[model samples]
Target: MENFVLILLAIVIGYIINRLNIFSKDAPTILNQFAIYISLPAMILLQIPKLSFSIDMIIPIIVAWIVMFISAILILVLSKFFSFSKEITGSLMLVSILTNSSFLGIPIINAYMGESAMPYVLVYDQLGTFIALATYGTFIASYYSNKNKITFKIMTLKVLTFPPFLSLIVALFLIGVEFNPVITKVLSSFASTIVPVALVAVGLQLQLRLPREEIKPFSVALIVKLIIAPLIAFIICKIFAWDNQASIVSIMEAGMAPMITAGAIASMAGLAPRLSTAIVGYGIIISFITTGFLFKIIS
Candidate 1:
């Protein structure tokens, strides 16, 4: 109930921001920059360094890999069935597979599952979703854009250099190191702001529009992402692949909706703005329904 209320509040606040123009046109750029360089790094640092490694990352990775892989396959099939442009197909693939595992992901998990949920979500996103986005997603986006060729080597470098990715790496190295009281306090304060800011950003970013061609692409993404993904995660859990918290965690991650970052990237790459916008908006609306459903079932 609290989570739902918070989401509602976020939506109202976001709508207000959109109406008042306080964000101006530049807010998205500034927010993305802040999230990447500041908030994301702070949150990653707080989580990564404190843990022993888990073999369980394998299942979640497999689950995530399967989700992304299936997304591509589905898009290819969608191409056959639906006749979207290459750019639109690329946009759909990016949005469909790359769940919003960062901004909105952490908070939603934290709220329903607990702060302990952070580790599972981060490792899954860092090792799986984010990595896939950097390599596979980038390749598709680049290929469709066809401006310049980007090699795997350059792409790997770019991935590693991203602030959150770098922070995750550093945190791994710092594992077992103890933090002083003052340092812990500072980090706690820094870590606390990620969720609220993200929800606000989500609200500010929301838009509704008529879907071209009946928005069939969104309906497909909505079903696959919000429904099918969680079902697969549940099967993995029930099969004894992940137990209890880990199962819940994987389901949480899998249940995530489209990453708005995908939309931003699609727009930046100059391919299929219309499709990207639909995926972002429609994905969120449907995600609210599915995430709540997953939370209830998992609980």
Candidate 2:
């Protein structure tokens, strides 16, 4: 509850700062760079080393990918049906296919399902969403934004060179090793900055009023992300008879809003920048109600 409140407060503060024009136009870019290059890597180094992979953990990961894959296909079909341009289609793919499974998922799930569900949340984020962000996300950004033909080698190189992905690789090898107390504390401090820094960055870019052309894409993104995606997860859980805590957490994660970083990537790639920000901003606000409704249905 406290963490959820903090997210809202940080967003409000960022919105206020933007409205006052207290920061330069490049402020959000600087914050996002700090998050991607510094805080996100620190977080991976800090958390990934603590994870112990097991067969039991595969459920959430599998479900997360399934949801993303199905949703991505749906987005493609919808894009064709609506005759969306390449930029709008790319923006929808970034925001809707990826989910805010960590920053929002961890805290929100903790508040709803209690601390016992943390492991599943972490699994869904790191093994599923995080890896997808580094790999599939890089692919989306490169493939959609560029007019030139992108090759598999270029995609692999980008994933390998991504800061957080490199950190994740290093962190995996250090799983059994212990870190120095002082170093751990330093990493922890940096890791903690991702949430507020990211939310504030999102708020800084947020615009409530949408241009007329963006309404349909924005609406489609939110519906796919917050409602349709999770509903798919829930139905799969029933199909598999996964009536467990892990399944519950996975369902909630599937219901989360657009990934803030995904939106950042879309905007950075010049893929319908304003529309991307609007979906990410409003998606978070609306997901609160939608997630609550989902919890009642699934739980």
Candidate 3:
């Protein structure tokens, strides 16, 4: 309960800072980069080496993939009835298929389940959502834009070259190795900044007000992300009889907001940038309520 309060406080502080214009508009981007390139990798390095590898570890990744595939199929079928344009369809695909698993999921899991859950969260984000974004996400972007053709080489390169993904590889390699005390301490220091900084970055980027026309599309995307996706995860868990903390965490992660990076990708692909941004923004707000509800039910 205390951790939940702290999470809210950090978000409020960040929102206050943004409302006051205490930081430049670029502040959120810089903070996000710092979390991605520096703090997040540091956290991964510190945590991943300690996790025992198991078949269960891969469940989160599978759950993520299942959610993405299901979402895609549903959207395609729904488009037949809804008369959505190519751009709107593309934007919905990006928003519903990907999630803010890293920035938002990490903190929420940490707050509720603590650092012991970090390994599963990392697996869900890196192996699961990140891989989907690189491969499936790029394909959707390319398909909508009709610009650059996506290839396996391009998708593989994106995943392989990501800093945190590389860190995961290095961490796995060092699983049985010992690190010097000083080096471990330094990594710990950097890792410690991840949650607070990430939450603040989230607050800075969050946008609540949207044009009325956008509300319908944004709500549709949010229902898939915050409601349907998690429900799918829950059913998958039940069907597999995977009753464990990691499985629960994966469900919660599925309910996270639309991926912020996915929004940027959508815009660059000439999809509906305004709608994408609004989905990301409003989705973050709704996620707080949905995540809290999930946590209560799970607990």
Give the number of the best model, judged by lDDT. Answer: 3
When sorted by TM-score, best at the front, the candidate numbers are: 3, 1, 2
Candidate 3 per-residue lDDT over residues 135-160, each given as its tens digit:
98999999988989888999899999
Higher lDDT: candidate 1 or 3? 3
Highest-scoring model, TM-score = 3
lDDT per residue for candidate 2 within 34-115, as digits (tens), equals 9878987887787667657665568899899999999999999999999999999999999999999876786678778875
Worst 10 residues of 1 by lDDT: 50-59
Estimate the TM-score of every prediction: 0.92, 0.85, 0.94
User: Root-mean-square deviation of each candidate, in angstroms?
Assistant: 2.0, 2.8, 1.7
Write out the backbone clash pairs for model 2. Answer: none
78: Cα error in model 1, Å: 2.7
How accurate locally, in lDDT, is each candidate? Answer: 0.77, 0.85, 0.87
TM-score of 3: 0.94
Q: Using TM-score as the measure, name the better of candidate 1 and candidate 3.
A: 3
How many clashes does the backbone of model 1 have? 0
The residue-by-residue lDDT of candidate 1 on 1-299, one tens digit each, is 67667766876787688879988876666666776687778877887666666766456677777767766787779767888777777777777778888777887787787777787788878888888888887887788898769897989898988888888888888878887879777878877766666777777777777467747776777777788777877876787656767667777788898888888788778767777877787778777778888888888
